[model samples]
Target: MFISFEGIDGSGKSTQARLLAEMLRLQGHDVVLTREPGGSPGAEEIRRLVLEGDPDRWSAETEILLFTAARRDHMERTVLPALAAGKIVITDRFADSTRMYQGLSRGDLRGIVDQLHGLMIGREPDLTFVIDMDPAKGLARAKGRNGHEERFEDFGEGLQSRMREGFLALAREFSGRCRVVDGDRAPEVVAEEIAEIARKSLAWTQKA
Candidate 1:
């Protein structure tokens, strides 16, 4: 099974992804935990270019191209191989992120994103957890990280707010695979919920 965790920055999706991987590993599952824009060597290089520097370093159109290229490299080098080996692949972020960030955040370019996705990266996670959080609080947590990859956070609270809404809408759009999880609770609480859902999904997939 391919699983992904997505949310506004600092919405705890990253932590949740890690927790899920660890929990599954403890249960004797073979799992591969990865993240987009940097999952493979080529994609890692692209990650630095797109994630660092100023918020205006790349326009939405340019970012779409860069992200797509990275995703293609990731799929070819990291994701596809592991899946073929029968390992469950879990990623912190995936194409859903691009659909929200580069597609809708800057402007109304979701159509272009979808077109590029269908042509270049025609895959989606079997299960996606969109951790929902208040934009203002998320921004504060993201900024508190003080990491070099602050380009997106630098976009300010307004962008985060829009992203929260965009992600929720995206969950609705892809209702079959997307699961919206509330992110305001304790980490353990959130992790438990995700683990239970993932456990059920994994069982169902195995039966199928």
Candidate 2:
């Protein structure tokens, strides 16, 4: 089984991803915890190029290509092999992020994003947890970290708001595998909910 955590910056998806991975590992599941743009050596290089620069450093079209390239490398080097070996893969973010950040944040270029995704990286997570949070709150949490990868956070609350909406819309669009979890509660509370859902998913997968 493959799982992905998606949300605006500081929505706690990363923490949730980690928690889920640890929990699953405790249950004797072989789990590979990774993140996009930095899962592989080649992808790690691209991560710095795209994530550490200025927000306007790359155009949306250019970002789409760059992200797709990184994702392809990540899949080839890390994701595919893990899944083939019968491990559960969990990633911090995935192509849904690209579909929002580069596709809708700038202009209506989802077509381009989708085209590239289908051509290069055709796999989607078997389960996706879209951690939902308020835009302003999410931005504040993100900025509080003072991390270097503030390129997207630097885009301001407006972009975060739009991205939040885009993610929610995306959940509806891909409802089959997407689950929206409110992130306003305490971390343990959120993690418990996610773990329960994940356990149910695992049981279903096994029965199938």
19-77: candidate 2 lDDT, tens digit per residue: 99999999999999999877999999999999897889999999999999999999999
lDDT of 2: 0.96
Model 1 C-alpha lDDT per residue in residues 78-120, reported as the tens digit of each score: 9999999999999999999999999999999999999999999
- Count backbone clashes in candidate 2: 0
RMSD of each: 0.5, 0.5
For each candidate, give its TM-score against the true structure: 0.99, 0.99
Candidate lDDT scores, in order, read 0.96, 0.96
Q: Which pairs of residues have clashing backbones in candidate 1?
A: none
